[model samples]
Target chain A: MVSLILSTAVRYIFPLQLLFSIFLLLRGHNEPGGGFVGGLVVAAAFSLVALANNVWTAQRTMGVNPRVLIGVGLLAAAVSGLQALIAGQPFMTAAWIARDIPVLGKVGTPLLFDFGVYLVVIGVTLTIIFTLMEE
Target chain B: MMQVNTVMNIWIVLPILIPLLTAVGAVLAWNWRRVQRVLSVIGSAALLGAGLKLLLTVWTDGILALQIGSWPAPFGITLAADLFSAIMVVLAGLLAVTVTLYSLASMDMERESFGYYPILHILLMGVCGAFLSGDIFNLYVWFEVLLIASFVLLTLGGERAQLEGAIKYVTLNLMASALFLAGVGVLYGIAGTLNMADLAVQLAKMEHPEIVTAVSMLFLIAFGIKAAVFPLFFWLPASYHTPPVAVSAIFSGLLTKVGVYALFRVFTLLFVHNIRYTHTMILIIAGFTMVTGVLGAVAQTEFRRLLSFHIVSQIGYLLMGLGLYHPAAMAAAVFFMVHVVLAKSTLFLVSGVVHWLQGTYDLKKLGGLYASAPGLALLFLIPALSLAGIPPLPGFFAKLALVGAGLQLGQYVISAVALAVSILTLFSMIKIWNEAFWKPQPLAATCASAQPVLLIIPIVLLALVILGIGFFAGPLFTLAARAAEQLSDPAGYIQAVLGGA
Candidate 1:
């Protein structure tokens, strides 16, 4: 019942949006576009896909349960803080190991925590949206 | 014997962390329901251990203060645990474990699958965070976390009755949150600091005392609503009886107490400069809250609803200690809080079991619990009697301490009301006993025979704690006294958190 052109456009747009989200997430620590924003962006893209196609197709694209995504996201964030506990520092005291990745600059616990935040925002948003859409 | 170091700070943070991790873990393994259940219990146990360590560490090392991200005070968020905060955190941990244990048996599988464990742990994380936070803004953040979780838990079943209750609960609490935030914003604007200890020092030096008093009134209304004091308490009984009993038990145990704790903390630490005015208002509110709440309870015929009303009434006693504003009174408040948290939750948990077995919370329909489940009937008596301020019970000591403080302070009218409220409280509790246990069943319907081990364990454990507190009141009173001394002296708190003394 839907137009082929719109679906085709969404297919291309989804991957591009996802890539942009990753860029925003990686750039977050030093820039304005952080995990929360990036995650929201990705969730918005997925929502568009679901709207264009169907929720089932969107779920297939996600491949993992959104609830599990939330759990993993929380773990990642907690681990970033736990690293400080392990190193005999105060809890959540950011400690970094400089490993230069090509475009992302130095990767560190703060970035890791931001990544976790990104996933959590994505998971929570998609979970709520998907449930409401199904209803 | 206590080493004050960065590593020690981890102990201060673990009660919050452990619950967060557990909630995450439970959610991640949602597909495996058994795994989720096991993980939640283990997580709660770990929190209890963490709480014990934190309490012991604070008891030995003085106030244990730590800055998250190693940022110094006035700039970074500090999680500081003095004797009072430590006591609260430990009590939270204890409540968490017992409540979770009760939920394991009493809660339905459908509810558990609806992310119940994750939400419960998050609620505890909020509570521990609220207790440990040294910044007013951080406290607000924690309050939001707990509030959100509570909203989910309260409305999880999607019953028409629950939905109605949830609406009232959420609306009033949201109003409270808004008021609290407004007060925090004004306080921050005036003092230019969010750290509670720092705010205390700055507030003392501020030239505009009138604005400070206005801000204090804002806080009083906000906390008064949350604490369900007097005219502000209509929402509590309206909503609390609607939740699943485990949910009710925790809410009954910790939620309002958190509000009372905030009132005590802010008034004693930051708003002390205007005590004659602010505390006298608190004293007047406390007196009315007691009379109205007990009278409401006397009029209730339902089980959980009666307990809900009692929670409001007991808040009056807790606030009375704060209103008195002396070390003995404050210590009594702390002791009474601990007693209420344990005893009240036990009553709710018992109500859960009765509901489970008898299939109703209405006292009119229920009868002969003593004949049907003698063990549960017995378990109920301990907390019930203890609640009524029977001698040699923890509640007796708790009430005695508060009344003594009131009498000592020569607040005779309030003291008389406190004594009178205890008698009325006993009368209502006896009403429950006579209707639910002593009276013959109106219908000879068969009650369930088997007692779930998971359910009984928490009930028994809580009862034992109430009894323990009653018999061995020495150590607890001393600890509470130390906490009271710290609360009485805000300079000591400020120096410990800000100066690392």
Candidate 2:
């Protein structure tokens, strides 16, 4: 089973997978990656953890329930869309910024929207995986 | 401070922002049920206030627009609230408040593992955002927001029936999303701008009539699936009856109306010039949709299923008014949509109470509920009769407006069909009354006990709203008429989106 493989590999690879997911989420707005893809990657990582350690352990390790993740994701996505309203623009109007920070420079609403998408992807993906595993 | 001109721009964003903030607040308050309840109530109330405030401002001042991130109009996303969008936001907010109250009493906390209040708030946020978005692509994003929330709500309990229904609901909606995306792609390719107001301007200047017609047809098909218009309506009745009563009530009240709202927006603003072909097709479809939907209702013995089918039947009237395209007719369509939301949601909730008492929504098995639950029966009667278009109720006036508009246009055949459908609607409602309320009690003493007051209060309040709209038809009708006028004349909308002429 996939769980067997995940269990063996999770002890060695979870942190790297988590880092990969964050990278995907952060780079999504400009590149081919974004919230949805990032969320999926994160969910896949969690699934690997679940497969290795058992669903409960995986759930506990994530530190938040999948359903809560979904709620948070929905809230995040909605907030990201509403950012347009703050600027006197319409809903879900993608707004961005180019900044020169010490290391990172740009931030925008699309990235936020992508983050929302990431949460939704992780929430939905885990909801399915966990529910199926429970069954 | 010199009176700045930009204060009004904030009003445009208020619609989406209030609900979004409230959703977050609701989630954060989830650990404290009392705080969650207070947050949800106040949040929705605030949204309602914001919506009304925007409506009044628009009524006095005309249209308002906001440019996100200081970007110029054509390139940046625009959030504009004209008469039409403002009214929808207010209505959506009001319904949301009532549904939240209803859910507070009805939802099972154990089964609702995720934060139920938060999801409901976000769903409202999505609905409001969709109504307020000025661009086509943004509308797609809002639709997905609402659709995903609804999918979760639909299958919340994971009952066998709920899961089955959710599968059909999700799959069908995904297909509709694909169709919507395709339509947007074609439209963007042809017109070169996804902004609705900009598209309207460009589309007006384009010469190829055939291409315009094809694009309009694509929009019709895409929105039709969402609105549950005749050919695309089968998925609605199948899935709608499966969700819990409160979830079903909110879904029935708000979701399809958003679709209807979108169709009206796109057709009136963007595709108005192609009236002959599109209008004629709409008229034909509207007529069939009314008759067939009612026939489906008549065939149903279950309370929820019957109401689900009736939702389809009533949508026909809304579309008919739009198809007529007269200002009065469009106003009637707006009025009809408001009436249906109030009436249908009341009926669905009453059915919930019936199920709580008799353990069934089957009409044959649900006799003498009137004796046991007189308050519920009365709550049921108002919307039921209103839905059947009985005089002095909102539904009656809504139907009257549509019928009058049909007659004014000399669309006699369609008018006649509308009359026939109204009569059949009455018949089906009476059938529900006869089987569910008037017949002798089918159950023992325990089943005859009073229903939960918490649940009944929301239903009664909604019924009151129905009556209030009916009695004070002047102001609301005027509001609807103003929205219709704005819809008919896209000048203000275009100007607002293209950054204030």
Candidate 3:
């Protein structure tokens, strides 16, 4: 019932894909990668985990319910836009940190918005995939 | 200078943003069905308040335009609300609140646990976004968002009938979306702009007027299907009655009207270059849509199916206002839209209550409503009479506004058709009354007891609003007139959005 080679390979591939997805999410504002792409990567990673072993293993790997991710992602995106309104600007007007903050240099609302998108993409894709696979 | 105005425009975004946030909140509370319910209700109330503030701001401060990300005009995503869009957004909020309330009593927990409230709020977000979007492409994006939510809502329980309806519904809507996108792409290719105000400006200066006219036809076909105009309306009656009646109420109330609103917006704003041809074509379509829809209703014995057919006919009336292309006619169209949303949704809710009680939607299997539940009968009468254009009801005034405009414009043939359709509409309403309420009980066991007070509250409140609009038609008419003025002459709209471009 188990494929040793594939499951072992997935252990390495899954974490690598997740790390790369985070990199894409962080670098999205200045580079080719963004939340949507990164989210897809993460989703792909989980799907690979499911394929290599079974959906139950992948479900356990994704610790939280996928719906929670969707909600959090949407809230983050909406709240990022509201920051502009709170700062006496029109809603969704990009506001940025003037100084560099640790490893993330010059954070902005767009990146936050993109992060939300990443989560939503991951949440939605995983939920659909997991539900269908489980069925 | 523009920076100062952006701050004032913050409220303009709330109508869209509130729903988005509400959708998120509802989703987050997915594990707790009660929390999702509370979130939808409170969020919709906030939406209503925000819509009213936005309407007041637009009324006093003129049009408010917001450029997302602080991008400059003609280049950024623009959300502009004139009086018309403001009114629509407010009405949408009202629909949201009432439907959410209705869902409290009507929706089963099985559906609730499936993220119904979240999906509903997401649908509202799409609606508000579509209304506020000043960019045509942005409107398409919002349409997709709402359509996806609707697809989920339509088949949430996966009933066999729902799957059948959903298949036809999604297939047709997807076709319409493709057509609309193709039209938008061509329009962008021609004008090199997606901002509606900018498109209007650029369209005026284009060398090829004929190309613009052809592009206008593309918009007409695209919106025509979505509007469920004649020859493309089979999908509506096929799918609308399949969903939970709360879902049906919102769909019947708002969905097709979006198509109508878009047609009115684009035609009056951008496609005025070929009024003689396009308007005439719209007028002809309006006439057929009315006749065919009413004729279809006369044949349906089931309750919701008849109402579904009436929705198609009513679209014809709204389109007639558009086809007439007069300021008064456009104002009438706006007024008519508000009336239909309230009255039609109330009717659907009433149907929901009846179905909940009687366990069937078939008219033949229903009787003794007047005998068993006279109060429900009376509540139903308010909207039904209003729908039939009876005196002292909003429907009467709505029809008067449209017919008056039609006759004033000297379009006698369409005017005659409009009058004929109203009488036919009355005939069908009377038919329903005779069959469902007035007739004696055909079976004693099938008689429905009194409905829950909570369900009746929405019906009564909506009826009261219909009555309120009827009695206080003066201010509302004035507002509709102002909105029509902006549509016919977009100088105010273009000035506000483009800032002297």
Candidate 4:
């Protein structure tokens, strides 16, 4: 099922798609782009690689296990919510920083939450894809 | 107010967090069998502890509501616990602890190591979330969470029968979910908010009741299927008996009960404008559900399959209590929920232990438990008798209260039907006793060598709880009556959530 041309094209295309996904995530604070959309884009990037080459190659390229990503992502999202307990807000209250960081812009727990959503989406999407493809 | 709520609300949140964190721990330690197993016990116990505390807090402190992210009512995702929700949380936690312990002996290592424990805990998280959530949309999310987890548990072993059952289970449930989402959308369109409290307030002042009535039907059918009542229960008898007994035990305990919980919650709180039309319809359905369910059980030859039919039958009684709408009846209904959850799950766990020993769930091929294993016979008899509504057991008291309430109102037909169904329930339970335990030992039966004490422990623990409920029926009924009173009037619940609106 592999095509040399598809594989060659995906090598360059995948990184760009990932960068775009991160961009979507960053712009999510006050814009249409957010965790869900950004996560879909990243999943699409990896899926493209899987389509061009194969699942094992894509797995190696991704570096971390999809399930581990889910675990870490959930932990991050939960932590982002619970961090509010320290600030004396209710659980999941969006605590924010008054200053901006480079590339990420003004930081907050919501952004961390978004990032967590991003990773979970990628993990879940790929796991489903990989399982179906293998079957 | 926010400061006070922040401290008070952790009880609401901890039930959910404990499971989520434990599932995370299991996933992170994916290959570490010992850690995952240990986490399962400790996590489930923590949930139980948290639920008990939450129950006490709600009992003494009155109903508690928390607006997540500090958003005001009608806007934020709210978590609230009246007595009803608290009771459900405690039941779920208890089921979790028992089922998790049972899985340690009954479930195979392959299934356990293949992410079973983690998914099971996630299922618990979803159940707790569903119980505590105070918004319609959030309830849907929790429903999906539990749905997804149950789907995995249903198909965990990937057997042919499991896949077949999973298809029916998932397809019907997904269809029901679609209807539920559509109902939520239409409801939000009409009421302009997703919070249940706000909807209640807005809906009470609604001018045209037809649209609301129509929306109410959509919810009724949606939850009806989940509750597996009357004609909507084709999926229950098909899929429930196919899962590993441990999965069946938890699903039997918590899943349908959640559906029943939602039905009563909405009927009491959200859709009280037209009781004559809605409650009467519910009553009719409840009667049919009872008759059809017991009749189905009488025809089943398999142990778990037979019990599965009884699940449908028992659900009819809960709906009957709801339909009656008497305070005493509703209190009896709550007590019935507590009894059934403990008793039914224990029944499934016993079935698992039987299969572990006899190597089959087919009632035809099994016999002689009475002579061979008196302890197991006693364990099975406790729940089976309670389920049949025998005296001195919780089931008997539940039936007496419900029938008493119906007869008091001169609803003679349903009352007669209720008494008749109790007789049939006893008939089938005795049928099982005669066939599987009381009769002579079959020629081909070879009892397994190792009767894992692990399998017996949960059954024994739950059996004691059943007896305890029976012995303490007076206080339990008093508490249930108090809960029923609170449910009958939603004003206090609304006040607790929305503040001095």
TM of each candidate vs. truth: 0.98, 0.89, 0.98, 0.98
Name the best candidate (by DockQ): 1
**C-alpha lDDT of residue B97 in model 1:** 90
Clashing pairs in 4: none
TM-score for candidate 1, residues paired by index: 0.98
Over 4 Å off, model 3: B446-448
Model 3 sits at a Cα RMSD from the real structure of 1.2
Error of 3 at B135 (Å): 0.2
Q: Please, what are the lDDT tens digits per residue for candidate 2 over residues B1-501? A: 102425666676776777777776776566777777788888888888888898888888888776665566778777778888888888887888788787777888753436677788778888988998888999999999999888878887788999888888888788888998999999899989998999999899988968988988888888898899988988899999998898889899989999898999999989988798898899898998999999999999999999999999998999999899999999999899888988998899989988888888888778997787787788889999999999899888888989998898899999999999999999999999999999986655356376677888888888889989999998999989998998888997898678544
Better of 2 and 4 by DockQ: 4
TM for candidate 4 is 0.98
Residue B113 in candidate 1, Cα distance off native in Å: 1.1
Residue B4 Cα positional deviation in candidate 3, in Å, after optimal superposition = 3.9
lDDT of 1 at B5: 69
Candidate 4 TM-score on chain B? 0.99
Query: Residue by residue across B1-501, what tens digits does model 3's lDDT show?
Result: 577777669778888888888888888888899889999999999999999999999999888898887888899999999988999999998999889899998899899999999999888888888888999999899889988989999999999989999999999999999999999999999999999999999999989899999988888888898889998999999999999999999999878888888999899889998899999999999999999999999899989999999999999999999999999999998998889999999999999887877778888877778877888889889998998899888888888999999998899999899999989998998888888888875776554476777788888889899999999988999999998998899888899889975
RMSD of each: 1.6, 3.5, 1.2, 1.1
Q: Which of candidates 1 and 2 reaches a greater TM-score?
A: 1
Each candidate: what lDDT? Answer: 0.91, 0.84, 0.90, 0.91
lDDT (10s digit) by residue, model 3, range A1-135: 678999999999999999999998888888898899999999999999999999999989999988899999998898899898888887888888888788776699988899899999999999999999998
Model 3, residue A72: displacement in angstroms?
0.5
**Candidate 4 falls in which docking quality class?**
medium
Candidate 1 per-residue lDDT, tens place, B1-501, comes to: 113467777888998999999999899888788898899999999999999999999888788888888888889999888889899888998999999899888888999999999999999999999999999999999999999999999999899989999999999999999999999999988999999999998999989888999999999999899889999999999999998999999999999988999998899999988889999999999999999999999999999999999999999999999999999999998999899999999999999899888888899989998888899998999998888899899888888999998988899999999999999999999999999998988887667878899999999999999999999998999999999999998877898789844
Q: Rank the candidates by DockQ, best first.
A: 1, 3, 4, 2
